[model samples]
Target: MKVRAYGKLNLTLDVLGRRPDGYHLLDTVMQSISVWDELDIQTSRQPGVHLQCNKDRLPTDSKNTVYRAAKFFLEDCGLADQGVYIFIKKYIPSRSGMGGGSADAAAALRGLNEMFKTGLTTEQLMAIGARVGADVPFCVMGGAARCTGVGANVEPVAPLPDCWLVVCKPPAGMSTPRAYSILDQYPLSSTQATPRMLEALEAGNLKRVAKCLGNRFDETIRLAPVRALKRAMVDAGALGSMMTGSGSSVYGIFVSEDQAREALETIDSMGRTFLAQPCSGI
Candidate 1:
């Protein structure tokens, strides 16, 4: 079986608190975008997982999350005899707070489930995914959602209204560990959640949705070049814009397709650009 896993952007991410497990508790609005990776999996006569990818940035070893995920699932279910090869075509930039790797791993799990007919429930898949990474579970079940409890707890949120998205990535990658450390060392500034946008989404109000868009990470990430790109996009005509995840890539939401293309040209980068829209579900 083959599956295409899509990347995610955070419109609103607030670190609620640190957990006893040492992972931070989070309250974030996550939206899946069109930027995606494809994973192909099928039963193999060979005895173990074999993986290949066109992206040199991605490691093909067992250290790779997708390889680890397939191992985790088969070992957990005593399906070690099943063998497979995964071919991944990646477009999402790595470590840009875009959840590319996590999405790839989730896609592998989903493909395996179908190939094996495991009939694993969503909760079961999520539980297995969580063991791999905090964002893994959420990626497994694609869509817009409110994620909490270190990304394990996912509550369905109304999808953001149909809008064009322009994403920008900076040259420097923001280390997730470093971002966490920075947050730990520094006092985090607070921002109000976009309850109005959430309401707008539920009501299918595109204008209101654009008006209510917001993210708390702006205070930290905006100190860098990424903030400038985001500003450029907005100034060029994005209806709404914000930094996506921990740092680096930012997205501009636009009402008109033509407006979105214009916004992208304003922020055109050697880095990367993904022109996409809000999807209903994963």
Candidate 2:
């Protein structure tokens, strides 16, 4: 079976607090973008997970998150007796505030569940995913959500307004580990994105939602050139704009798809751009 693993962007990410376990408590609103990676999985007569990457950018070994996800699922289901070969075709940009790797891992779990008839419940799948990475659980269960408790506790929320997104990625990639380290050095800013955007969403007010969108990490990440790209989008008449995850990639929301395409054209003149709509559901 084959699956398309959709990438995500955080329209509103607020670090609520830090946990005793060194993980940061979060109140984030994340939506999958149209950007995705293609995964092909088939049963193998062999006894271990084997991975192949068509994209040169990603690793084709156990170190890769997709391999680890396959390993985790097979072991958890006592299907270690079985094996599968995964062929990955990457399209989403890595380490650019997009959940490329996480999405791939999530897709693997979903694919294996269907192909192997594992019968693992959603909660069980999420639990296994959490052991792999913080973002894995959410990707396994897509759609808009309010994530807390180191991003594992997910509360399904109403779908976000349909808006076009223009994303710009700079040449430099921001490491998540390094971003968290710098976060500790700075004083705690406001964890305001969730509450404000939640109100807008409940009201189904697109204008208000656009106006209220924010990310706390932007306060620190704005020093990079990607910020300039966001500013440029605003100059081109974006309804609202912000950096998605950690840093190095920024996006602007527009009222119409046409406007978004125009904004993308502006970015394409200078840098890479992804034009996509808000994902409605999984």
Candidate 3:
């Protein structure tokens, strides 16, 4: 089975507070983008998960989310005796806060279900996915969603209006844990843009959606490249721009493909860049 696992962008992210378990509460709007990673998976009689990636630097063992997800799914489904081999064609950059790893894990769960002929429902798959990673549930569903409660609780929302996005990731990547730690130092605020962003999405108002773009991490995680990239995006005619998820990768929303392509010409050489649009249907 072959599966295309798509990355996501945060339309708006707000940190609520730290939970007793140390996981930070989050209220955010997440949208799957056209950018994706491909996974080719097949079942085997051998009772172990085998994994390979085009990117040699990534781990192929239990440390990798793909391997862990395979184990989790098989165990949960009472198919622990079954095994699978996974080959990954990676596109999304690691640690860029694009949910690349989670996407891969979600794809593995989906492919394994098909390969094994398991009749699990979408909700069942998403529930199992949540055991592997916070973003896994959202990645499993794919499209526009409001994710809260450490990002495992996903509520599908109306799709955003068609628009082009220019995504850029700097050489330096930010750690999610570290970003949350930094955020914990500051006191909580009542300000939140997710509700307004959702309202704009429901109304199909692209301009309002652009104006409502916000991220709580932007206030605490100050990376010069991220700031510069946002400015460059606006200077190149982006409707609005903000860093997605934790840090490192930034995306700019453009009304048209021509404008997005023009902005890419100016920002592409600056770092690893990609031009994409809103994606749906997994």
Candidates in order: C-alpha RMSD to true structure: 1.9, 1.4, 1.0
Q: Can you write out model 1's per-residue Cα lDDT over 1-282, one digit (the tens) per residue?
A: 668889998877877678776788787778888888888777778978999998876789887889988999999878998788889888788867889889998888888888888999878888888888888888988888888878778888888777888888878677788777777765543555645556777898776766666655566545467767767877988777777778678888888889888877777763677789876425
Top candidate, metric TM-score: 3
The positional error of residue 155 in candidate 2, measured at the CA in angstroms, is 0.6
Residue 78's lDDT in candidate 1: 85
Q: What value of lDDT does candidate 3 attain over all alpha carbons?
A: 0.91
lDDT of each: 0.79, 0.83, 0.91
What is the TM-score of each predicted model, taking all chains together? 0.92, 0.95, 0.98
Query: How accurate locally is residue 148 in candidate 3, as Cα lDDT from 0 to 100?
Result: 96
Q: In model 3, where do residues sit more than 4 Å from their true spots?
A: none
Predicted structure with the largest lDDT when compared to the true one = 3
| Minimal lDDT window, size 10, model 1 | 186-195
TM-score of model number 1 = 0.92
Candidate 2 per-residue lDDT, tens place, 1-282, comes to 889899888878887788788888878888888888999999998988999988776788877999999998999888899989999998888778888888899889889999988788777878888887888888888888888878888877876787888888778777898888888777655657788888888887888988888887887656557778878889888888888888768888888888888878877865568998878424
Q: How many residue pairs clash in each candidate?
A: 2, 0, 0
